[model samples]
Target: MISGLGLSTGVAEAEVESRRSGCLWAGTSHSQGAEVIAGGWAFACTADARGVPTWVPGGATSQAGTVPNPGAYTDPQGLFSPGARQPGTSYTDYCVGNQLVEGTNDVYQAVESGGLVFWKAAAPISDWNFDSNSPRPEPTWRSTSNCYRGSLL
Candidate 1:
């Protein structure tokens, strides 16, 4: 015999958005076919008649980092092409660098190669003032908001 029992139900809300508003801007590299998007915006890096990569901001200009280069490398990995697979290694070696904390000048990129994708982000070592041994003040993307929406199973 079974007593009165039932499964409990509740609603879980989820949303997705860009983690960092400007830490890294989204733009295409000067390649034949490469597409990059961030924060629900498409960054198109078009080339001029002379084959120079140009920055085309889809939504808003990024607060920090440099404009992306299109098609420069076949496998764009952390600071190095064919980057490491571990996310932590890439983030630390490139994004955070030797700095104690993450900086805004850090730039990130997504590369697709051999039917696989790689991600990398880095901040310029020069951005840190050696004399003071402190990181330069710049806008950074700590985390994204509203980037996903679904119910937890």
Candidate 2:
């Protein structure tokens, strides 16, 4: 799930849509074999286990630079602490430099809500500048409502 695909339908219907439509990066859908740059990485719209269009790792974009550390990273707030990982869950996290948060290099978690996906600080809610008009308890960190902004983390 790349997030913000607007696929609220059941799995069967989504599977069919995946075959018909190409891959969806943020929210906007794209045809098969399309390439997108997300979070400083180059992603190619590829097929998944069920042949659903997915963002596959093409390579690191120039903006990505080098991965701070190749292997897994340890968040200051203990993101990788012992027993932090729950059973039967799939997630991937990388070292986010000064992109999301200003100046301070921190670890963020990619959480899904609605048809959109956004990253929030792994440290605490206090570190963020909340949107005054957001409807949820946690503020929406996105720049806009549209899913595909390209510059989003």
Candidate 3:
């Protein structure tokens, strides 16, 4: 019975669990107030919406006041690179040290395709810290284009 922006009614438990299993943190979008999942030691993105997806440079925070990576970096040479070279279009290279949780450095990117926008995030390294009690999963990338419908929901 989970209800919120981008989530359809009757969402299955398995689906929710799957999303949770892979994400280090999942919550709402900072700018659009849409739900988002991040920090999974891999790249992940949400499905396309009816309208353009809002990119929050400051990243999103949880209800508990916890802020994730907050979109601090940009990849000019990699995928999800913004259009044209411009100020505020690039950021420091994202790495494990930039993550909210230790050993969970992941990058989140939003892109447009087929008249829809999608979010992408990934954590490229594993075992960032040998002493970390909980080792993050292997580096990976994922994207979901159907997770949102637009600013309307």
Candidate 4:
């Protein structure tokens, strides 16, 4: 195991082949240290489903001690699903250009680019009620209340 903020040490490395999982399991023993005070760090390995080592973002000695992707990385399966998640639900709330939204279930990804949010789904939520767009007259408490109700919660 690699060492870092989580503080982990590799004690043993063994390969176990299994047809059920259809891969070689590299059993590793790790010793975790106490809560870190400073120098927070994390560690991960690059390996295929099999015990064989695969070239992942970061390898033991790949790219002069630099990982392939720093801020982002893709999974073995070609899928790019990103977004803010709500607790205890697969449902995600996507955003568009910093405009928060309630997303649907079709597309499973959300991305923020150029100060705007984009979704992979075909359709997105399209209902915005600004304070000025309230039905009530201006300077009226009813208008303000209507605006708040029209807007998201």
Candidate 5:
């Protein structure tokens, strides 16, 4: 049996009954079509199944360049690793990189505070001393409060 009770937004009350599977189901919902609600509350953003926030194309004012320091030769995998300096190298600073550490890059952990994690990436560092004003690519790392819920792999 199937029926539609006619609801707003092209939605309708639905009912289904099947004897082959020996089951009955009834539900009501709306299509994922674009619509606005009262008081201006709407789904302004789109995300993956895991709830990772994603931006729509041409929706941003200006997108940042390549993400910084994805990972390094050495570092355990976890959350976001920030401010990790390369051994025997001073030219790189991963914290300022455009890399999304928590999503894809390495997750650096804090020895003292377990809740803290660092996100790092290679980025172009601007030099004020040079009149050319060319940004030199270097490691840019940043630290943020990491409340790691879980991991995919």
Candidate 6:
């Protein structure tokens, strides 16, 4: 039985294997403390409260890390999949180079980059209608868009 992870004989081993999976950074997975640079910023491999590894950007590391392809790291995701969610669904937004998007292809990619158009946190789908209108005007409202209606709650 693992000390911190309390599990019976059968499950303990499998749990341990999953726990050490490491952070997914750049275009690959990395172990804890492994650091890398993406989109011209600094990032360190770390784990979240749930123990899932993820990239947390910090001051550039001592070893000048490599720069990965911007496209691979920042492809927008759910922004196009209307079937995955409905119009009024809540979503997590991410920005790539000043443009806030609904979803991204890679969580790691959206998290970093050295581009002039740095990503700023985009507004959540639920909060688009703040002051009667929206900051991001899309072609249509009542549906999922970068700024669908910007006000529908």
The digit string of per-residue lDDT tens for model 2 on 34-152 reads 76543345556655555534445555454432212111122212111111111111112222342332312332443333423344444432332222332223222332322233233
Encode model 4's per-residue lDDT on 113-143: one tens digit a residue: 4433333443222211112322211221122
Q: How much is 69 displaced in model 6, in angstroms?
A: 3.4
Give Cα-based local distance difference scores for all models. 0.30, 0.36, 0.30, 0.24, 0.23, 0.37
Per-residue CA lDDT of model 1 for 13-92, tens digit only, reads 11111111111222212342333442223455554344323324355332332333322123433222221111122133
Query: What residue runs in model 6 are displaced by over 4 Å at the alpha carbon?
Result: 1-20, 60-67, 72-148, 151-153
True-structure Cα RMSD, model 5 = 18.6
For model 3, the stretches where C-alpha displacement exceeds 4 angstroms are 1-51, 59-106, 119-135, 139-153
Give the residue spans of candidate 5 off by over 4 A.
Answer: 1-46, 54-117, 127-153
58 Cα displacement, candidate 3 (Å)? 2.5
In model 6, the number of clashes is 11
Arrange candidates by TM-score, descending.
6, 2, 1, 3, 4, 5
Worst 10 residues of 5 by lDDT: 18-27
Q: Give the TM-score of candidate 5.
A: 0.15
Residue 15, model 4, lDDT? 19
Q: Write the per-residue lDDT of candidate 3 for residues 1-153, one digit (tens) a residue.
A: 345666655557655454333222223222323343233222223222433333233333222223243342333222232111111112322233323231124333444455332344433333111222323334323222212432111
What's the distance in Å from true for residue 68, model 5? 20
Give the alpha carbon lDDT tens digit for every residue of 57-96 in model 6: 5653334335333222233231111001111212334334
| Candidate 1, residue 113: lDDT | 52
